[model samples]
Target: MICDRFYFESIDSLHVKINKLIESVAIIAIKMQNDLRQTSM
Candidate 1:
Protein backbone atom coordinates (compact mmCIF):
# COMPACT_ATOMS: atom_id res chain seq x y z
CA MET A 1 0.00 0.00 0.00
CA ILE A 2 2.74 2.45 0.82
CA CYS A 3 4.51 1.64 -2.41
CA ASP A 4 1.37 2.21 -4.40
CA ARG A 5 0.86 5.62 -2.84
CA PHE A 6 4.44 6.62 -3.58
CA TYR A 7 4.09 5.50 -7.18
CA PHE A 8 0.98 7.63 -7.62
CA GLU A 9 2.67 10.63 -6.02
CA SER A 10 5.59 10.36 -8.39
CA ILE A 11 3.30 10.18 -11.38
CA ASP A 12 1.39 13.23 -10.20
CA SER A 13 4.55 15.29 -9.85
CA LEU A 14 5.74 14.21 -13.27
CA HIS A 15 2.44 15.24 -14.77
CA VAL A 16 2.72 18.68 -13.15
CA LYS A 17 6.23 19.18 -14.48
CA ILE A 18 5.19 18.19 -17.98
CA ASN A 19 2.29 20.61 -17.88
CA LYS A 20 4.57 23.48 -16.85
CA LEU A 21 7.00 22.68 -19.63
CA ILE A 22 4.25 22.64 -22.23
CA GLU A 23 2.93 25.98 -21.00
CA SER A 24 6.34 27.62 -21.25
CA VAL A 25 6.83 26.23 -24.74
CA ALA A 26 3.49 27.56 -25.83
CA ILE A 27 4.29 31.00 -24.45
CA ILE A 28 7.62 31.06 -26.28
CA ALA A 29 5.95 30.07 -29.55
CA ILE A 30 3.48 32.87 -29.21
CA LYS A 31 6.19 35.40 -28.52
CA MET A 32 8.15 34.28 -31.53
CA GLN A 33 5.13 34.56 -33.78
CA ASN A 34 4.43 38.06 -32.56
CA ASP A 35 8.02 39.11 -33.09
CA LEU A 36 7.96 37.80 -36.63
CA ARG A 37 4.82 39.72 -37.39
CA GLN A 38 6.26 42.93 -36.01
CA THR A 39 9.41 42.55 -38.06
CA SER A 40 7.51 41.81 -41.25
CA MET A 41 5.37 44.90 -40.89
Candidate 2:
Protein backbone atom coordinates (compact mmCIF):
# COMPACT_ATOMS: atom_id res chain seq x y z
CA MET A 1 0.00 0.00 0.00
CA ILE A 2 2.76 2.41 0.87
CA CYS A 3 4.52 1.69 -2.42
CA ASP A 4 1.34 2.36 -4.32
CA ARG A 5 0.92 5.70 -2.61
CA PHE A 6 4.48 6.69 -3.42
CA TYR A 7 4.06 5.72 -7.04
CA PHE A 8 0.94 7.85 -7.31
CA GLU A 9 2.69 10.80 -5.71
CA SER A 10 5.52 10.59 -8.23
CA ILE A 11 3.10 10.59 -11.13
CA ASP A 12 1.34 13.63 -9.70
CA SER A 13 4.54 15.61 -9.46
CA LEU A 14 5.50 14.63 -13.02
CA HIS A 15 2.16 15.85 -14.24
CA VAL A 16 2.71 19.18 -12.54
CA LYS A 17 6.11 19.56 -14.13
CA ILE A 18 4.73 18.80 -17.58
CA ASN A 19 2.05 21.45 -17.11
CA LYS A 20 4.64 24.06 -16.23
CA LEU A 21 6.74 23.16 -19.27
CA ILE A 22 3.73 23.43 -21.57
CA GLU A 23 2.83 26.83 -20.16
CA SER A 24 6.26 28.20 -20.75
CA VAL A 25 6.24 26.86 -24.30
CA ALA A 26 2.93 28.57 -24.95
CA ILE A 27 4.22 31.87 -23.66
CA ILE A 28 7.26 31.59 -25.89
CA ALA A 29 5.14 30.81 -28.94
CA ILE A 30 2.97 33.86 -28.35
CA LYS A 31 6.00 36.07 -27.99
CA MET A 32 7.42 34.75 -31.23
CA GLN A 33 4.18 35.43 -33.08
CA ASN A 34 4.14 39.02 -31.88
CA ASP A 35 7.71 39.51 -32.95
CA LEU A 36 6.99 38.12 -36.38
CA ARG A 37 4.14 40.58 -36.88
CA GLN A 38 6.30 43.51 -35.89
CA THR A 39 9.09 42.49 -38.25
CA SER A 40 6.69 41.99 -41.14
CA MET A 41 5.30 45.47 -40.69
Candidate 3:
Protein backbone atom coordinates (compact mmCIF):
# COMPACT_ATOMS: atom_id res chain seq x y z
CA MET A 1 0.00 0.00 0.00
CA ILE A 2 2.77 2.38 0.77
CA CYS A 3 4.44 1.64 -2.51
CA ASP A 4 1.22 2.24 -4.38
CA ARG A 5 0.75 5.60 -2.71
CA PHE A 6 4.27 6.59 -3.51
CA TYR A 7 3.81 5.62 -7.12
CA PHE A 8 0.73 7.77 -7.47
CA GLU A 9 2.48 10.72 -5.83
CA SER A 10 5.36 10.41 -8.20
CA ILE A 11 3.01 10.34 -11.15
CA ASP A 12 1.25 13.45 -9.91
CA SER A 13 4.53 15.30 -9.59
CA LEU A 14 5.54 14.24 -13.05
CA HIS A 15 2.25 15.52 -14.44
CA VAL A 16 2.82 18.89 -12.80
CA LYS A 17 6.33 19.12 -14.15
CA ILE A 18 5.14 18.28 -17.65
CA ASN A 19 2.47 20.97 -17.47
CA LYS A 20 5.05 23.56 -16.43
CA LEU A 21 7.35 22.53 -19.24
CA ILE A 22 4.52 22.83 -21.75
CA GLU A 23 3.69 26.30 -20.52
CA SER A 24 7.30 27.38 -20.81
CA VAL A 25 7.54 25.97 -24.30
CA ALA A 26 4.36 27.76 -25.35
CA ILE A 27 5.69 31.08 -24.07
CA ILE A 28 8.95 30.61 -25.94
CA ALA A 29 7.07 29.72 -29.10
CA ILE A 30 4.95 32.86 -28.82
CA LYS A 31 8.00 35.02 -28.32
CA MET A 32 9.71 33.49 -31.32
CA GLN A 33 6.64 34.03 -33.45
CA ASN A 34 6.53 37.67 -32.50
CA ASP A 35 10.20 38.10 -33.28
CA LEU A 36 9.68 36.58 -36.68
CA ARG A 37 6.79 38.87 -37.45
CA GLN A 38 8.78 41.95 -36.50
CA THR A 39 11.70 40.85 -38.61
CA SER A 40 9.43 40.28 -41.61
CA MET A 41 7.85 43.69 -41.24
Candidate 4:
Protein backbone atom coordinates (compact mmCIF):
# COMPACT_ATOMS: atom_id res chain seq x y z
CA MET A 1 0.00 0.00 0.00
CA ILE A 2 2.74 2.44 0.86
CA CYS A 3 4.61 1.79 -2.38
CA ASP A 4 1.51 2.30 -4.44
CA ARG A 5 0.79 5.61 -2.74
CA PHE A 6 4.33 6.79 -3.39
CA TYR A 7 4.13 5.83 -7.02
CA PHE A 8 0.96 7.81 -7.48
CA GLU A 9 2.42 10.82 -5.71
CA SER A 10 5.44 10.79 -7.98
CA ILE A 11 3.25 10.55 -11.04
CA ASP A 12 1.20 13.49 -9.86
CA SER A 13 4.28 15.63 -9.44
CA LEU A 14 5.55 14.66 -12.85
CA HIS A 15 2.25 15.62 -14.41
CA VAL A 16 2.40 19.05 -12.81
CA LYS A 17 5.92 19.63 -14.11
CA ILE A 18 4.95 18.60 -17.61
CA ASN A 19 2.00 20.97 -17.54
CA LYS A 20 4.17 23.89 -16.50
CA LEU A 21 6.67 23.11 -19.23
CA ILE A 22 3.95 23.06 -21.87
CA GLU A 23 2.55 26.34 -20.61
CA SER A 24 5.92 28.03 -20.90
CA VAL A 25 6.47 26.64 -24.37
CA ALA A 26 3.10 27.93 -25.46
CA ILE A 27 3.82 31.39 -24.11
CA ILE A 28 7.15 31.48 -25.89
CA ALA A 29 5.49 30.46 -29.14
CA ILE A 30 2.95 33.27 -28.87
CA LYS A 31 5.68 35.81 -28.21
CA MET A 32 7.63 34.62 -31.20
CA GLN A 33 4.54 34.92 -33.43
CA ASN A 34 3.93 38.48 -32.30
CA ASP A 35 7.54 39.40 -32.97
CA LEU A 36 7.30 37.98 -36.45
CA ARG A 37 4.19 39.99 -37.24
CA GLN A 38 5.78 43.21 -36.00
CA THR A 39 8.88 42.62 -38.09
CA SER A 40 6.80 41.97 -41.21
CA MET A 41 4.73 45.12 -40.67
- Number of the top candidate by TM-score? 3
The best-first sequence of candidates by TM-score reads 3, 4, 1, 2
Better of 1 and 4 by TM-score: 4
TM-score of each model, paired residue for residue:
0.96, 0.96, 0.98, 0.97
Sliding window of 10 residues with minimal summed lDDT for model 3: 1-10
Clashing pairs in 1: none
RMSD of each: 0.4, 0.4, 0.3, 0.3
* Local distance difference test values of all predictions, in order: 1.00, 1.00, 1.00, 1.00
Per residue, candidate 3 scores C-alpha lDDT tens digits across 1-41 of: 99999999999999999999999999999999999999999
- Report the CA-based lDDT of candidate 4 relative to the real structure: 1.00
For model 2, residues 1-41, the per-residue Cα lDDT tens digits are 99999999999999999999999999999999999999999
Error of 2 at 37 (Å): 0.5
Clashing residue pairs, candidate 4? none
Q: Is candidate 2 or candidate 3 better by TM-score?
A: 3
Clashes of each: 0, 0, 0, 0
